[model samples]
Target: MFLDNLSAFLTHPVTGTVLLMVGIIGIALELLFFSSGLLALAGVAGFGLYFLGFYLAGFASFGDLAVLGLGLVLLILELVVPSFGILSVLGAICLFGGVLMASSDPKEAAFMLVIALLVAIVVVIAAIRTFKHRGIWNRFILKEQLTMSKGFTSSPDRSNLVGLTGEAITPLRPAGTALIQGERVDVVTHGSFISVNKAIIVVEVEGVRVVVKAADDQPNH
Candidate 1:
């Protein structure tokens, strides 16, 4: 007797459609080729389709509401709480139970499940395409910027400064070159300008030049 009733319910068109949609959705989610939004959409549509089919088949409205509420709660929990393994399992249970509760016949519920899977699958594919096209899903997501910010520094070449400090390189007519460590570098005189080769200290280093000042006063010649 139960088998005959189940067979008759499965023959319903609405039941079959929901079942197909559910299968598709399940496959799409597993493959990761769809977006979350698409999944949500499929869930909503699948729920509605199953509910309508059962209502048309003469199920009591009150029981249907209770079942629908449970399904909705499950979905809400999925979004509100961290998965924790419990939310997903509970949500699936609630959803399946809700469909069975809402349906006038068990076979109709099965049919709707299949349709729901199919819908889920299609939506999942669309979701994947949507994400890929947005450029967010690409391997190299960031394009290097041409303009660099301040504070960026590169390593200096130590050999470039090999002999460029402490020599009487600058004449100090306020400006001239100094030979320090065997290299010529521009330097400046501090306080009063002095002639070249009167003993100097490296006052500062700016780029290729080591600025200097006379240690003591000396003859202009």
Candidate 2:
């Protein structure tokens, strides 16, 4: 009797609509805000209640429930494991299929799915603009800028070596090491291979890259 009464209430259009909205909103907020799983739990609960109500009302078959459960698992996996949106796409298809199968009215299910998608998109965009720098995204993204002021350099500056002459320590197939000012420095030639022990001049220095040419070769400048 209690189950029947609960089903009678849940099967009402208003109750189903409310439950569906709550589930979708909760899940979206969980993904966007990373609310320490509170919103996710609430969303799970909402979905659980919805499925139970529908099952009791004879609106959902075992297969429908299984499909919905699989979809929910895939969606959760998408959050835990990044598959570059593959899991999300599959989960969406399964979720929609399950909803359609469970609903007596396909039109109503489709309408609700559309609303859910719109809400999710809006929430994701807003969250990205507001909280992107702080939350889960930060874990997988590089947010630091490497500038001279920050003492971050990709390589040591070789500008001081310009106009200096050095002997090639290794054959330069356009790239080799040279002893300049008694310090071994890496250098590249202008599309020409230089033999080992060959005398070379530092023709240019761009950041960490030292450009060299044969000592007998005239400097471009």
Candidate 3:
């Protein structure tokens, strides 16, 4: 009888609704507060478990497959193309659809949604515990790991601004604009805001950004 109750509890409408709420909240927090540490990983894991539970409950359907496909595509797009919100929007839609499809009934779907949401909360909490002081994750799911996998790739140098002298087109209050070699470029000052049109000398060159200081302050140009 306990097994029966347990099964019933798993399918309970209130339980599912709670899960869905927690999942959505987790996803929202993860996406919005990206710097919130391990929240993002927790969100992903929560979404996975939510659907996995629904599928195991024999509530899956054709719609769930479509949702899974769309989710995967959207997820891939996120990694390929960096954007502010496209990935998040598509991800949410796909996740919602997946939950909806997996449930045998609307009631079950609702229940699963709640459960999934709760799972997201738990994952987030756990992630916070594990990754609190660590650096970025940069994994496939997190994308932090992927960046680390690629290592530090230097940017291309298109501008031959090295060893060139120019004037400040705009005051760089630490980061400002300076004209070098007839081409206007952004530059960093040595904690001094060079006045506009101030004669500046390039001290070092790295990638596109040039470091500059007042021409008079330079010991060697």
Q: Rate the local accuracy (lDDT) of all candidates.
A: 0.56, 0.79, 0.65
lDDT of 3 by residue, 1-221 (tens): 66545546655566556556655665555554454536445555555555555555666655686786577457545545656668867876787777777766866575556566566677666776776544224432453444434764456563466567789988778888887778778889768878888989887776766788888774656
The regions of model 1 sitting more than 4 angstroms off are 1-12, 15-46, 132-221
1-221 per-residue lDDT for model 1 (tens digits): 66445534643665556454653364235324334447556656655655654555466376765766565566556555646547656666666676667666667566666667656656766877776654323434545443326433343223344333465644578777666667665666554576667677665555544456665534489
After TM-score superposition, what is the CA distance of residue 113 in candidate 3 from its true location, in Å? 5.8
TM-scores across all candidates?
0.41, 0.71, 0.41
Separately for all candidates shown, the number of backbone clashes (residues 3 or more apart, or on different chains) is 41, 0, 19
Model 3's TM-score against the true structure: 0.41
Estimate the lDDT of model 3: 0.65
Report the candidate with higher TM-score, 2 versus 3. 2
| Decreasing lDDT order of the candidates | 2, 3, 1
Poorest 10 consecutive residues of model 3 by lDDT?
Answer: 134-143
lDDT of 2 at 150: 95
Best candidate (score: TM-score): 2
Clashing residue pairs, backbone N/CA/C < 3 A, model 2: none
Select the stronger candidate by lDDT from 1 and 2: 2
Please report, as a residue range, the 10-residue window in candidate 2 with the lowest summed lDDT: 11-20
Tens digit of lDDT per residue, candidate 2, span 113-152?
6776676667667867887776666777779988989998
